[model samples]
Target: NECASPQKYHVDCDSNAVCVDTEEGYSCRCRPGFADISEAFNRLPGRKCVEAVNECLDTRLNQCSENAICEDAKEGYICTCRQGFVDASPNITHYPGRICNKPRKPDDDHQVSHQLDSCNPKDPRCGNNAICTDRKNKGQFICECAEKAFRFDDGSCRLSAACDVSNDCDKNAVCANVFDSYKCQCRPGYIDLSPDPETRPGRYCKELVNECATNAHDCSPFAECIDATDGYACVCTDGFSDTSSTAGLLPGRKCSNSSNECLDRSTHTCDDNADCIDTPDGYNCQCISGYVDVSSSANLPPGRVCTVQTTCPKQKTDLMFLIDGSGSIGSYVFKHEVLRFIKEFVELFDIGLDRTRVGLIQYSDQIRHEFDLNQYSDKSSLLHAIESTHYLTG
Candidate 1:
């Protein structure tokens, strides 16, 4: 037969397959623990067979219960109940039949004694501030606080004093519930006159006067009141100065008259090219000739700026330069720098009798008139006259 002496007769099968002598020739059949690659019962020559796959590795192939642990065996898998659980169907202890379940608690009369025997007085699971008692029921034990004043919070008993409304305390004080007891404290802006504010039965508080905040001071509408320890003081607001002969902090201080801010140089913020004129309430800024006021608003404070006119404005301006020709000033500075600066400055303005007239004067111990405002009618003539002026050092 082909199965006998297979190697010599040219009959070969896979190592996991068996060589069967058929009626015609020979066939290869996979072993009980193996499978053919082609899924055929018998395979021809050049076919293969492989070892069966372990069923426990795949969940669909292993029929273990939900609460059971699976273990791979030689041919299949084994199922056992997990920890803290037991087999529900004790008659069927194998996989696909055994169902896992937790142990049942005492719910009937027959199981009540079993629960009572399990309780250990020394090892009750109740937390602090509470006492544990056996219930002799399905739920075994319960925890309760000892005193009626203490209430259960989280896992412990805490003191809770009863305080609902402010009227429960003195009229001048408000009621507050602390952890252990209730207390009465004075309100803000009031001082407790009692000797012992903590242990006193009723609060006796005196009202601390705030005349500035309450508008109780005899101050004018234009003044602001400043609260002091003994009394309040009155001070005039902005744009209004104190006109009273008395000091600013005095009781009868008056701010009825408007003060002239333009008289004081430090108080006025007028630009160099502008003039500050005092008004009824405030001051006004007036730009000089050949300069334009570029202030956004006229009513705004005195820091108004005046810019030079891009095109010279046709206005009557009699401009004069008083040069210092004293001995302290050197002749070179007078002739070169001084004369050049004057010529450049004169060029900025329109020179004419109707528009702007130019004049020059030299002064030391005595003054000398170099030229009058009516002398030059044109800019070129004015510039030449300024350049030719002599420096008299006396």
Candidate 2:
């Protein structure tokens, strides 16, 4: 009668346990392999049975084979063949408990080159602009971008980045990626001027100039001007050419009349018998100390006929030629000796308007004046007059 009692009259127990009624009372017992999940109860003490936690959920406890997957089961866990893997023996199959073995190629020697091969698509290798190669002897593979290629998430590749780091520019320039290729540029203040400006990094830093050294300028005939960064200026135009180095003229100045460029033997046109005298404008040629210009005109070209000054008078002094006709001096000695003495004395002064004045007188002859000191203005004219003078013998 109690076993046939209404559901409400039946003994109460854990949902996972069966209720057993005895003459004294009712007790709770776990089902098949389940155990009481609750150890302590808040109220009445009784077994609160529940299905045991599947140990397979703890992968550590139910560690399946490398190629297998652990699956939770009614009583415990089961190891099954993972996707792309198969059991060692087809007939040895067990529901949710099959042992897994790595798949083998029809051509057994065709080993996969990478672990990712297990989840590989139809075309496991990389696509355009990418490379797929074996990692090692193991059945595994690695996919990477090829030379100058950029890889996308979808495993596709595209050409790009001919350069990566600055070194890729070979230290010749700055490098930039233009999506498809590398771009190089020179730095500021640098210029290649070549057809292609991106030649090297050095081209960017190369010095650029407007090039003033070669152009001509509007300088004086006595000066040579050269180009400078700011503008142009006279360099070789300074009158002090004699002191300037042969390399170039003194910087930042103009030529002056006082500059004696002719003093420098290397730059003068005067003859050996001539002297180079510097003028404010340029230079001039003059007869040397021991020479005279024989040209008809006072102004003569360089290398002209030059006679010796002969220590002859040169313009600025008073000269007198005195003759002695005394009886003690014989007529022969008087003519030769007296004449010789006059000629020699005359040579000591310069004969010119601004130089010496020459005169002649005969002694013992009543002091007759043959010529006055103001007679000739030049040495040549005075010398000629002296040669033509007649001898007065007393």
Candidate 2 per-residue lDDT, tens place, 1-57, comes to 333352767655666666666685555567876755332222122356656778766
Number of clashing residue pairs in every model? Answer: 0, 27
Candidate 2, residue 283: the lDDT equals 76
Candidate 1 wrong stretches, greater than 4 Å: 1-313
The estimated TM-scores of all candidates read 0.22, 0.26
lDDT of 1 by residue, 96-207 (tens): 2246554333243542321222334577654444466655556555654333234322334432322331234567654434332344555544556667765763367666
- Please give the distance, in angstroms, between residue 361's alpha carbon in candidate 1 and its true position after superposition: 0.9
Q: What is each predicted model's overall lDDT from 0 to 1?
A: 0.62, 0.52
Pairs that collide in candidate 1 are none
Candidate 2 lands at a TM-score of 0.26
CA displacement after TM-score superposition, residue 349 of candidate 2 (Å): 15
Off by over 4 Å in 2: 1-129, 134-143, 146-149, 152-162, 165-172, 193-195, 198-205, 209-281, 288-308, 311-394
